[model samples]
Target: MMKIFGKVAAIVAGSALVATAAFAEDRKSYPAPKDHPLSEIISGYEFRTPETRALQDDDFENPAYILLDLGAELWSTADGAAGKSCASCHGDAAESMKGIGASFPKWSKERNKAITVEQQINICREEQMQADTWKWTKDPNMLGMTIFVKNQSRGMPIVLDNSPEMETVRKLGEEVYYTRYGQLDMSCANCHEDYYGNYIRADMLSQGQINGFPTYRLKWNGVGSTHRRFKGCMKNIRANPFKPQGEEFTALEAYMMYRAVGLPIETPSVRN
Candidate 1:
């Protein structure tokens, strides 16, 4: 992993040298909705090195496919008291799960709160499959299945819930995004919004988009969820991170998704 990251670091450093000349060319920004804060929205992919982008572009080359394959197998394998697999109820994922990834961090009327795709997966396990819920950040199966499910919706534009309840959640997320936290006294907007396209150490700041989540980050040497990245960012700021799948994170996800509106899903995206 160190060897791979070393190569990536070298490439990133080289890319940074010409970054000023290519800044506008490299960024792929879209016109934001009239109500959105920024005039344009940029995907995290824009900040990645060419090699990392190439990895995400090729399905076979993407390391995340290893976990995605496991998720596909698990989709058809029955378990728990019900002995029913995801395939049994959902039929083929390509058909049943299509366009589903873009509508995540949805409002749950039953729960009276917003829930992420990870939370929904656990809900299915406990309620539909009669199986124990997978650990949020610990279980490889959780991350694998998420990547698989979201990958089914690759290329679809994000379309989040806009109900009154969801609006409340989105507002909460907006608050979290702007609020300064930790010993560093920095908010998410400080880096992603204020310093985007600028090099911070060796890494280029992005718009903090979550559309490409369950992303395969080279820094991690593996695929990880948006929440995992969130915790890492909090740690970087010397802040106490929120627990995965918690209300705060769910709200934050909703806000990020809202920010990424109209951006195509790029699950299992490779990033450095």
Candidate 2:
């Protein structure tokens, strides 16, 4: 009976060791490679190749073009007791909207907080237009209007002002970008920096540029806003994602757009 008990203990210990080893192996197996390194796990999902770059520059139109047209109409149409069109308040979009997107996710002195582009739009709706606040993500008018507004600034260089006021917002964005989180225990840098250009099971990595967003993804079968794409990436990491147009994501988008300072806008680009 003593010998049998001893054998059982040894067997249990051995099994525990094997289990530990398996867990370690599983952890390492994340971001699995298609090749040893440098090869994409998804062979075709590589970054904008020169060919794709050309496509980004080409004047290929999208059915979603109508979305922008509608937004432009909304911008000019007056509403509420204020009897103010968005244009009546802010004037023509070119002068009124220049550098707005790039400068957003910035600190707002009036609110004493950071403000995203969406929030800025809402502020105008409430304070200037005396209009009801638009809901986020689900509101086609809000999303389409913001997208249209942003498109007006296409090709403008990201020009977020670096000031003492923005110091805290900038730092917070940097912290979020570098901190490891979720089941995979990876930061943005792990995939974008250390493993960039390497295959993760099947797809090649790009420089992780956000400049080309509101992109037309093949997987989605249509164009998607940057916030939508951001949620997908957060889901891939198994992290609980923030709401689209939420503060965290707004900060992240600002940071990422800053990173891709020179990459041109690639609205409606095809990607895997």
Candidate 3:
């Protein structure tokens, strides 16, 4: 009788667990329409430029290119206690580092955390190069170096490797992507995916690609990093956004890059 009772209990517990999991899946939230100018612009139907049209080959010739050149020089120069250049460690980014930038915000088993490529760069400096780490978004050296490295992967598809370890980071990123926040109550996907190719005020919406980020924005009248673009979007939603280099932004970027998989990198892209 005890054995039979134990079996029944086990079956009941299994059923309950399954039910719980189903409920969790059903509650999964995604961005939806809310009353706001931005939200209306996103969901309202109107034509806009395609991703191909927003990009121009000449975009690289601007001042951003000059900064990129400086970054390359810094990359090859020796620094740190070991007197090793970033190149000495990572080797030629054009070849060795191809398709790398798009794979960032990966789960780090050693640290038991999700880490960004910027974080990994600093980690390498601290461990391999015996150098001081750069501030998250403050260090020009870090920004320049990262931009220089990312440019090496230009035209490569944004492919992010997935693993069990990356599940948490990916989920967090997905949550951010779909969750409505800020006073406007809008998410990234609401504009880019569901309402892509629509008009938002005078500006035309593209596919909202991230592979070409760290791009040149006509609105900014200059080239800016991906984080800058991110903050702008968040602010449009009226959300108190995190710092560009913070964890929230990192996860969001990871999610964006993952979605852009197979899309070629288009550094220094032009936007209206």
Best by lDDT: 1
Q: Evaluate model 1: give its TM-score.
A: 0.91
Misplaced by over 4 Å in model 2 are 1-46, 49-55, 265-272
Question: Candidate 1 — which residues are off by over 4 angstroms?
Answer: 1-21
Relative to the true structure, candidate 3 has a C-alpha RMSD (angstroms) of 16.3
Ranking by lDDT: 1, 3, 2
lDDT of 1 by residue, 207-243 (tens): 8898888988898898889999999999999999998
Total residue pair clashes for candidate 2: 8
Model 2 residue 158 CA deviation (Å) reads 1.1
Question: Candidate 1: RMSD over Cα atoms?
Answer: 7.4
lDDT, model 2, position 16: 86
lDDT of 2 at 215: 57
In candidate 3, stretches whose alpha carbon ends up further than 4 angstroms from where it belongs are 1-55
Go through the candidates in order and give each one's C-alpha lDDT: 0.89, 0.64, 0.67
Which pairs clash inside model 1?
Answer: none
lDDT of 3 by residue, 6-125 (tens): 999999999988875674343312232353122222111112234523344454444456657767898888878988888896778788777766666677889887777678878888
Question: What residue pairs are clashing in model 2?
Answer: 39-199, 40-199, 41-199, 41-201, 41-202, 41-203, 42-202, 42-203
